[model samples]
Target: MRRAAYWLFPLIAAAVAIFIVIFMIQINPSAPHMNDGTDGEESDTSPQITEQSGSWLDRFSISEEKGYFYPVNEVSLKLTDGGTATVAAHYRLTVPLKSSYELFCVKEELKKSELPYFMRKEGETMTLFVDSNDQNRLVSLVTKLKTYQIKATVSPYTEEK
Candidate 1:
């Protein structure tokens, strides 16, 4: 009985360790298929905008006079080849009065451009900057126009300078 118990103890511990390892693998299988493969697909990727099918816009009061900021708004990208892509708007703001704001908007058009000073695009993301001068320009420009709509698209990439 003593010898039997001694062997059973190690067997129980080994079984428990095996069970834990199996449970962990079952819970989180580290398989490559789990990834969406965006890294490889990004080279040929184009901008796409999600279609607004159910009219959720009606629920929210989307107005330029409301002095609201629409963060990460979706804008449809119109490609030169007569195709459309759905891209998220990094930031959209309608300034009713002069105000300081910090936001991000994704601009697909800027990505297609070669201008290094204004915009930068990498992979499937883009980043844009609205400095103090840009904010002032926005305030001045919107004041003159009775109604204005400003949509900014930004990339989510760090410039490699």
Candidate 2:
């Protein structure tokens, strides 16, 4: 009787431990529920990417406004040949200096160019907008800007259809 009682005590403790483990697993919030159509099952509504889809972009839907804008550093001659019409690539160049002296230098350089540009000062940063369609002008602007140690980034601006 003593031997049986000793073994029984350990057996009961083991059973309780196993029960606790099972209960914890069942109550875990992070577990992904399966789609078995049962009370605890989760619906398989999450988006899945398949091999047939070229990229994540194919699976996702993008609005008209989000698709076209690309920043340009240097002028590129590439045109949107097929899907949509693109007017120009926008560029952003930041001069490290915020002083009016530096700003004046930049303004003078831009004034020397024949290309049409829209300039605005926001705080210490200067924003220059140029038409993307004119590849020659872009090339010239990029070349000239580079001489002044000003690097520009080309962003795409798409025309709405």
Pick by lDDT: which candidate is best? Answer: 2
Report the C-alpha lDDT of model 1 over 114-151, residue by residue, as the tens digit.
22233334564443443332433434433433333433
Best candidate according to TM-score: 2
Please provide, for model 2 over 60-138, each residue's C-alpha lDDT reduced to its tens digit, 9 standing for 90 to 100: 4332233443344665566566887854555433334445665565667767865455667778576666554555556
Off by over 4 Å in 2: 1-102, 159-161
TM-score of 1: 0.24
TM-score of each: 0.24, 0.32
TM-score, cand. 2: 0.32
Alpha-carbon RMSD of each model: 19.5, 15.5
Of candidate 1, the 10-residue stretch with the lowest lDDT total is 97-106
